[model samples]
Target: MAKHCVCLTLDFDTFSVWSAMGQNSPTPISRGEFGVVAAARLLKLFDVHALPTTWFVPGITLDTYSAVCADIHAAGHEIGHHGYDHISPAGMSRGDEIDQLRRGIEAITRVSGMEPRGYRSPAWDLSENSIEILLGEGFVYDSSMMGHDYLPYRARTGDRVVSGQLPKFGEPSALWELPISWSADDFPHFEYFRGSGLARADDVLANWLGDYDYMTKYLESGVMTYTLHPFVIGRGHRMIMLDRLLHELKDRGAEFLTAEAAVARWAAL
Candidate 1:
């Protein structure tokens, strides 16, 4: 039988993302605060379904909302590193990147009493030093790059990409890459940013379910990851859609696995 795996991943950035963008105004801060409420709803949903998921949390979020983070861990979800303040890795110096990784890991360890085995770069942009830092820090997987849709691959380091030359591919490292895309991410679809209006949940559901349908029919074995943010997907309509999506996938025989578990299976292969 063909195997189809689904990883439901949440980036619990909360106010850190707005702070990193220098938007410390009351409105944005309050908007992020909604994540706490949303997380509770999501946790109840997961409990009802008995599904395991992954949460990529920033250090600031862990510090500011320690109890909420603890609740998530208590629910038996995997918590992964998501930087110190939701700052994009691509804009940081090597030292700053390393600092973010270490500080984020320490915060996670404090709450979960264990190091995160996976890292997902803030804003899905990886710096030149990200892969090396992840490897040195003993991270086994990353879920930021968009190199593939349904297959986990090795992360590469030191590729030379110039203005007008063929890209020099670098050697693959021990770190596995559980790729993600904007298409499967909730922020772009459901969140109304500066001017982007909210999308209809039914439409987004079609696209999400379609990806899994294709994976189940065509691939011999694969994993599809859907990225969600509590502030975005925690809304009433979207939450209902999420529940329906899970039911649909279950009826279709999709195997639910946390990103850490999915990556381990890939590594074993």
Candidate 2:
């Protein structure tokens, strides 16, 4: 039977940026700063249950909440860069992208006391230029590429197409692109603005159950990444449902691994 692995990834963008560009609501709870606290609570729950998760934090946010970052590292979770200041690589020049990635490396190393082994672009909006930058900067894997749910494939830094499912670049050729495939993303589902806010606990749970059941029935193991924002999943009202989801996954014999581990294993296949 194929063993299912669940990778929990949290995009730690502070509350300040959430309101910028009017993308998120102005509500205090919806803000990014509070999002950290929300994430911390969820982390505590995961720790109590001994579930492993991966946190892809922006450099600026990690700097602001070093304590939370430290705690996550201490809990044996993997920390990867979410870029510097939540800047999208797509808008940056090649030089600027490199500079941002370099800054991300420094920030993560300083805050977490360990150099991050992986990088995830902000908003899954990595420009073709960012891949070479990641490889050049000594990053082993990039987890922003999607469309595949079960494996980590290689993608060239500057050679990807503009659209229509970015092509895979080959392993050990350069930097590996790990897919942070989402089963349920919290920000869009919980926040009214993103159009994913209508995601109720029951609806999400049912979706996951169906997906997993199908995958299990085929004896197919795939990489499933859950995008959870602290503010959405950690809310007082939503925490119950969050815990229930975790419990259900555990009961289904799902295995949780850090992004680095997942990519490493996938690369071996």
Candidate 3:
């Protein structure tokens, strides 16, 4: 039988996102607070469907919302590293990035009682040193790149790129790459930020389902990851849409897996 896997991954950044962007005003801070409300709703929805998902949580969020983070862990969901304060590694010094990684991992361990096996960069941007850092820290996978849509591959490091030259590809490392795309993420599709308009739920749903359909039809076995934020997808209409999407995916024989589990399966093959 053809296996079509789906990983429902949530980035539980909370107020850390605003802090990272230097937008700690009341309005922006409140926007982050809304994620708490959305997370509860999503947890309930996941319970109703008995779905297993992964949450990429920042260190600040974990420290500030220990109970919520604990609740997520107790509910049998995987918690992955997302940075210390939603800071993107792309702009950080290698030392700072590593410090962020260490601090984030320590916070996650404190809350979940286990080290994270996966890491997803904040803002979906990884520094050139990201792969080496993840490997050194013993992370099994990273989900911040878009090398392929439906396939998981080993991550590469040390690629050479220039303004007007054919890029030199690096050799694959031991770390796995469970790629993500903006198309499958909720912030760009639903959040009205800096003039980006909210898309109709139906339109986004159609596109999401179409991707799954294509994967089911063409790939022997594949993983489709959908990225969602609590504050964005927890809205009434979007929550309903999410529930419906889960039902539809279940009906189509989509095997839901946590990001860590998905990466393990990919590595085994």
Candidate 4:
């Protein structure tokens, strides 16, 4: 059977993302607070559709909203590790990155009552040591890279890329790379950052659905991952668009699965 999977994943960063950027003003923090409200709305929609999705949440967000996080777990959703404080691992010291991972894992386990099988770095950026650290800590997959649009690949280690030198590629590791892309992410489309983002819901919806249609047309079996944020997609019009997306994808024969579940099925195949 042709297994074309669709994984709907959310990055529940809440206020930590703003904190990471040093934007700790009351307004920015309040903006993050809206995510809490959005989460509730999303749960209702998912329950209505019986969708099994994933939420990659930061440790701070998890701690800040422990009850909400637990509710997400209770609703039959996978909670993947996003990071401790929404700080990207790129340019971070190896020790600091490992510290972040440990904190994130601990928080996730504390709330979800299960160790996270996957990790998605904040801001979708990874350091040289991230893959190795995750593999060492037994992470099954990482969804922070964009190596492919409709397929997952092995995470690599030991790449030697430097200025004024030929790039030496790394060896593939056991860790899976459940890739992501900017176009499929909602932050850039909806979030008003640096005075720029705010796309029409219909336009963003068209782009997202178009990607799925293209993948189904070209690939016999592939994973179509759409990244969303509660604070971004939970707005009234966008929420309607999201609901439409779920039904539309269903009509298009989408078999929605959590990130971990999709990875397991893909790996087995």
Candidate 5:
């Protein structure tokens, strides 16, 4: 059978960045329950389609939003650790990073009853210590590298800390790094390209759909990773756009699975 995978991951840092994007310096916390509502609705859609999703949630998000995390777990979605807070890995000391990761993992486990088997850095902001921390935590995979636009390759885990790149796979204790380029994401487009939340959402979705169509046509056996932000993809008209994208991808014979499952299966091959 042709292998096609869509790893739908929500960068569950909604509340953390909500206030900052508003008036004051991105607040120390996020208060937009709108994101929570949107995420639940999105999960409902996934349930209807029977599409398995991977939610990359920060550790603190679980504490503040435990119900949502529990609901996602109850619905059979895989939960991956994003971080303790949305702290940038590049700015932390090695020891501090390790400690942060430990707490994050424990928090997620406490809330979801599943030790995150996978990790994606907050804002894709990864560093050398990040990989070492992830390995020490016994993570099966890390999806924060951006070596190639689509292909998932491997590298030494610890080496990436200083090199600021993907670890070359070969270290016995190395974890898989799932690469999903920025070009395939909506963050940059919405935050930078269009310069307006409303226009950015629409433009990015159109771009993503175009990218998805092309990938499905040319790379039939290839994997397509869809990264959605609840604050953006979960909003008013944009939610409809996301629904259309999901259903259309399903119609095109794509198999949607959690990032953990997809990487594990791909690694085996």
Candidate 6:
């Protein structure tokens, strides 16, 4: 039997992302705080379906909302490391990046009592040493890169790209890269970050389901991943659409799994 998976990833950012972006005033904070409310709604939906998901949370979010995060663990969802302050590591020094990684891991351990084996960057950005740092910290997979749509592969460590020179590919590291795409992410489609938000809910749902159908029709066995934010998709219409999407996926024989679980199954194969 062909095994097809649908990994629903939630970036449970809460107020951390807004705070990191210098939008910590009341209005923006309120906007981010809505995620907490939306998270409750999402958890209800997932509970109704008994679906497992991966939630990438920052240290600040965990520390601030330890109780809710504990509920996520109690519901059997995986809490993956995002960052300490919801800051991107693309410009950080080696030590700073390591600190962010360690802090996030420590927070996760404190909240869930389980060491995280997966990581996804805040802005899908990473410094040159990110893979090395993640390996050193014992991360099994990363979902920050966009190397593939549905296939999970090992993350690369070092690549040489010089001006006016052929690009050199780097050696693959031990960290599994469960690749992601902005196309499949709900932030750009739904969040009004920069004049590009609020697409028709049905339209976006069609596009998401179409991608899954494409995968099942073509690949023998594959993974279909969708990245969403509670604040973005937890709206009334979007939530309805999300529920319908999950049902349709279930009817189509989609097996839902956390990002980490999918990687483990693939690795075992």
Return the TM-score for candidate 4, rounded to 2 decimals: 0.98
Q: All candidates' TM-scores?
A: 0.98, 0.87, 0.98, 0.98, 0.85, 0.98
Error of 6 at 20 (Å): 1.4
Q: What is the overall TM-score of model 5 with all chains considered together?
A: 0.85
Error of 3 at 191 (Å): 0.3
For model 5, the stretches where C-alpha displacement exceeds 4 angstroms are 18-31, 158-173, 191-196, 200-202
lDDT of 5: 0.73
Whole-model alpha-carbon lDDT for candidate 2: 0.74
Cα lDDT for residue 49, candidate 4:
98
- lDDT-sorted candidate list, best first: 3, 1, 4, 6, 2, 5
Segments of candidate 3 deviating more than 4 angstroms: none
lDDT of 3 by residue, 1-269 (tens): 34669999999988888878899899989999999999999999999999999999999999999999999999999999999989999999999999999999999999999999999999999989999999999999999999999999999998998989999989999999999999999999999988994999999999999999999898888999999999999999999999999999999988899999998888878
Candidate 2 lDDT, 1-269, residue by residue in tens: 33677777877777635533455555642466677778678778988889878888888777778888888888888888888767778888888888878788888888777888888888777876677677777888888877465556787544544467977553344777777555557766566664447567777767766766666677456777778777667777678877887898889888888888887777777
Off by over 4 Å in 6: none
lDDT of 4 by residue, 1-269 (tens): 54798999999988998889998999999899999999999999999999999999999999999999999999999999999999999989999999999999999999988999999999998999999999898899999999999999998899999999999999999999999999999999999988978999999989999999999998888999999999999899999999999999999989999999989888898
- Alpha-carbon lDDT, every model: 0.94, 0.74, 0.94, 0.94, 0.73, 0.93
Least well predicted 10-residue stretch by lDDT in candidate 5: 20-29
lDDT of 1 by residue, 176-267 (tens): 99999999999998888888849999999999999998987888889999999999999999999999999999898778899999999888
TM-score of 3: 0.98
Off by over 4 Å in 2: 19-30, 157-173, 181-183, 194-196
lDDT of 5 by residue, 178-254 (tens): 88777666555443223543454556667776776777677745567777777556766777777777877777777
